[model samples]
Target: MKVILTETIESLGIIGSEVKVADGYARNYLLPQKKAVLASQANRNMLKQEKARFELQIAKEKAFAQEMAARLEGTSCTIAAKVSDETRLYGSVTERDILNALAEKGIEIEKHMLLLSEPIKNTGTYNIPVRVYADVEPEIIVEVVAE
Candidate 1:
């Protein structure tokens, strides 16, 4: 069945896109979930008009993401933890710690956006990759110091 997607669906289509789906799936899932509307002439005309606004909104979002990425690139976050005499952290720095540190620096980020291979076990400086946008990945330096 032909439908106009109201929002982006994984493995399907983006917002304001016209797509064809199985009749059963469209009727049972998309329609019931209000994720799409029937691709009638009237609905298609409305979607066409809304497409321009949607494109503009997406562009603005991308611009904001880029700006955030730039700011993050220039920023450094520091975290303090109690460590043993060997300079090894008693407890490693996890995603939550990174998120909290960033928040304290007036930068808000989600846990999933940080690409951390492993927690920090020793004290030093580390560069972490953060995905501020889907395409924009900026590296931020994190300094781990013993308390």
Candidate 2:
């Protein structure tokens, strides 16, 4: 089904773009979440009028994400955990552990924004990327140390 997107969906299209998606996906998720609307002449015209507003909002959001990226560029977190004889962590350091460490440093971010592909299971320094925006990703140094 063709739908007009109201937000930027990575898998889909950007704001105000018309695209065809599965019927069930459009009905169950997009419409219910207010992320898209039915593609119609009226909706098209309305979206055309609101396109400027959406662009401005997107610009502001990008700017904020850029600013946050700058702040996070020099930021690093140290996580202490119990280790075995081989210097391997008894328990892996997950995203929550990193989030808590950042919170302690007065930096707050959504869980989904932190792009941790897997848990840290060793004692070493690693760089993790934080997805601040569609095009803005900043890396933070994470040092996992033995306790």
Candidate 3:
């Protein structure tokens, strides 16, 4: 099905771009979520008229993401946990732990934005990427120490 995207979808296309997608996906997810609309002549013309506003909004969002990336650069957080052994922790350091540590440091971010593939199970320093926006990921130092 052909539809006009109203938001930037990483797997799909950017805002205002008309692209073809699966019928069920378009009907169930995209349309219901208001992320896209049917690509008709009237809708296309309406999107064209709103293109300038969308561009401006996209620019502002990118700028904000860049600003957040700058702030996150060289940022580091230390989490102290109970160690069962010299190098291993009793429990792994999860996203929530990292979030709390960041919060204590006055840096706030969503859990989904923290690109941790797995929990930290060892006591050491690790680099964790924080996805502030599209293609704007900044690595922060996470040092897990034995308490």
- The TM-score obtained by model 2 is 0.88
lDDT of each: 0.87, 0.92, 0.94
**Best of the two (1, 3) by TM-score:** 3
Residue-level lDDT of model 2, residues 1-147, one tens digit each, is 999999988678678889999999999999999999999999999998998998997888888989999999969999999999666999999999999999999999988988999999999999999988888899999999989
Give the alpha carbon lDDT tens digit for every residue of 1-147 in model 3. 999999988678778889999999999999999999999999999998999988987898889999999999889999999999899999899999999999999999999899999999999999999988878999999999999
For TM-score, candidate 1 versus 2, the one ahead is 2
Each prediction's TM-score versus the true structure: 0.69, 0.88, 0.86
| Residue 38 shift from truth in candidate 3, angstroms | 1.4
Cα lDDT, model 2, residue 87? 69
- Runs with alpha carbons beyond 4 Å of true place in candidate 1: 1-5, 8-49
Q: Lowest summed-lDDT stretch of 10 residues in model 2?
A: 8-17
After superposing all C-alphas onto the true structure, candidate 2 shows an RMSD in angstroms of 1.8
Show the colliding residue pairs in model 3: none
Task: Compare candidates 2 and 3 on lDDT and give the better one.
Answer: 3
Best by the TM-score measure: 2
How close to the true structure is residue 75 of candidate 2, measured as C-alpha lDDT? Answer: 92
Tens digit of per-residue lDDT, candidate 1, span 17-123 = 89999999999999999999999999989987898987886688779989889889957889999999668999999989999998988899888889999999999
